[model samples]
Target: MSGFEVAGVVIGALPLVITALSAYKQGKEVLASLRKFRGLLDGLIHQLQTQKTAFYLDILEHLREAMVPEILQYGDPTEEKCVGILLDAKTGTQMHDYLGPLHEPFLEIFGYYEKYLKEITSQLDYIVRLKDAPKDDLPNIIRASKIQNASLVFKGRLKFTIDRKTLDALVKDLGTERYSLGKLIKRVKTKREWEANEPTSSSTTLTLAFARVRESATLLHKDSLEVPTITVTETCDQLIHATARVQVKSICDDAQHSRNQGRVLALELMSDALGLSEAKHKPHQSYNISTTLADFLRDTAQDEDARMSPLNQTLLALNVVSSVLQLRPTVWCNIPWNSMSIRFPIRLEDDLRIPVCAPYVELAADANLLQSHTCSPKFDHDSCQDDHARDGHSTVGDITSQVHGGLGNKEPTRRHGNIHGPDACCHLLVGVEHEQIIASPCQGD
Candidate 1:
């Protein structure tokens, strides 16, 4: 049978089982054996009624929100009407059209109950037959049988009798099915709630934004944008925050435009100003950085000719640019972009040191000191330049100081080794290694 027909059969048989149990109860006075089984009959009837209520009412209540008006037109979503509409081949297309994703799960739930109900209905039918049997035959029907004691029939054909063991097994199987059905119902309810709350538009917009950012970072360096995986709760909160910010900004803009046109809109304008002031006054959240690019290169320059290669320097520059591009539009961009802000994560393998040339965006508590300090190459050049000159080579500190100094300069200046601009500083740094290689042979001679 089709799943719809099976569901209908199960629903139809439940009432029959309940009626049969009730009828059998009426025969308790005639057969003394029947009086002993009264509690079993009552329990089975109660369980059948509960199952019927679950199918007819509880499941329908959860599904009602997703159901279409066309389906409701058939009648209230009682078990018989629900199954009748599904059973109709004419309404088959409507089922999928109206139910969408819920159609399959709904059918699967019905299919599960249908499997357990077949056995239940058969056992109840046999009990009903015993109610009509002559008094002598009824005694034989209630006889102690070894089959009931030999083993348990959890799902298969049940041997019916007035014996406690057989009836207990039947009740146990019913309880198992009830537990399974309850779990399925809970699952369906959870799925429905999730679908209702899913932020489709906000998720799509955030995904697109992240994809663009990743693409831009990839162009600079493949591993430049290795962001940690955020938890689902965190991601959802971020999306909600972003969406609310956009909406609030849009509303404030509209209100300002209206005010400019001589219409007095006060509440939204006041809210917008308050939000900006609150965000501006809030204390910056700080995080510690193990080693910045400037710190790493300065430490390496202390050793003899331990300068980073030109290629690695170029890669580091690209990574810094990528990090700046990603953070520029966010709240984290409050600090200036300088050598101290560009971090390098270190890794060791087999006594070989590998430094990741990516810029870590976490801001340190002493970050304000970096902004307040004057950008002067003199201090570092005095300390490290003598070491480089003694070794017949320039230190990596010279390159870093020059680049960061250029960044700090508000206008192009002739000081700092006559570097015209930040662009010139970058160009000069790129060729520093090549100049060292050429000067190496001449110095040896």
Candidate 2:
């Protein structure tokens, strides 16, 4: 009896041991796979970082040489053949036609800027504010005072300058029409011409003076395109303090608003910086920020209206710089005590205002960091089951794309819907033509 009972126990224990061993092997495999995935991800992230850093360095490299000189040269009155073109009130269409060849030099100057910007895309970190600071302590329980951060404390709207003389000249020239009385009268019937010619000598005035003048000046043109600029301050201290609770939800929320404002500003800045409004392409769609920022530059910079004033040219260069610098999101890491902080060390500037669009795109983060953080998966909450496939119900994703054929003489554009977030971005393109700034409070969807 004792031997049989011992043998039965041994048989049962063998299966239990095998089951335990299988479980351990499975667990080890899972851990190994996770490590492999993380390693791969780290490599990819490093590659991305390297590529982006190189691009940023390239942009910075062009600073001393490419930016100011090009802008100054483009707007130089001496270089512009049409700058002092006389405001001829007669035959304006003819005058503009004559001045067309003169604007070529200015166009050639901005072409390089457009070309550079087109080469880089989606390599900015918007989360890090322009003015971020490193932490006092590190390698311990990481504190909130060590990460990248940004905030849009409203620096009121920027005032853009208008070229008044040019606008006025254009209006005056287009207003007047030259017509000879003899030719006009000749077009009239013989009877009317005879009646008009008869009152020459009998104490009646024979000649009538008719001078051509502009019918109206009010609608001729806008005085200036308002390129509104705002100051955005990114404190390293603030970013460090804010990154304590950095999560996907928060990043996503910020991204929604920031991108919206960014698009608007990009368009405004491009329009203003490029002198795009006055471009012969007249009220173009794609060149504005609403459609594509980089594409606009590449496409419209070649248009007839792509002639840029020096200020506008500066803005375009500035926009490219800002866009690239702003592409990277501020590095945020979660900390204890419900706090978040920035992970990277950064240099700070005093009350620095970098021009940018609002919420860039959300970033793909580390899984370990993600697992350790408090974030709710973006899934349907009402239908809850342990397995994603097991749940029969479908969750509709948030849709942002809609395609349509645009009006004639217009570029195809993307019309973004209203978004909800704590920080909303507002950009105005028509006024300045380049991406301009505005920081708004976050509102719920």
Q: All models: lDDT? A: 0.47, 0.26
Q: Candidate 1, residues 32-71: lDDT per residue as tens digits?
A: 5345664665676677787787666653543354363445
Runs with alpha carbons beyond 4 Å of true place in candidate 2: 1-243, 246-294, 320-445
Maximum-lDDT candidate: 1
Best by TM-score: 1
Off by over 4 Å in 1: 28-38, 68-70, 74-79, 89-112, 123-164, 176-183, 199-445
Candidate 1 Cα deviation (angstroms), residue 269: 34
Per-residue lDDT for 332-435 in model 2, tens only?
32222110111111123364322232222322344343223222212222112212224332221111000011111123231111211011111111111111
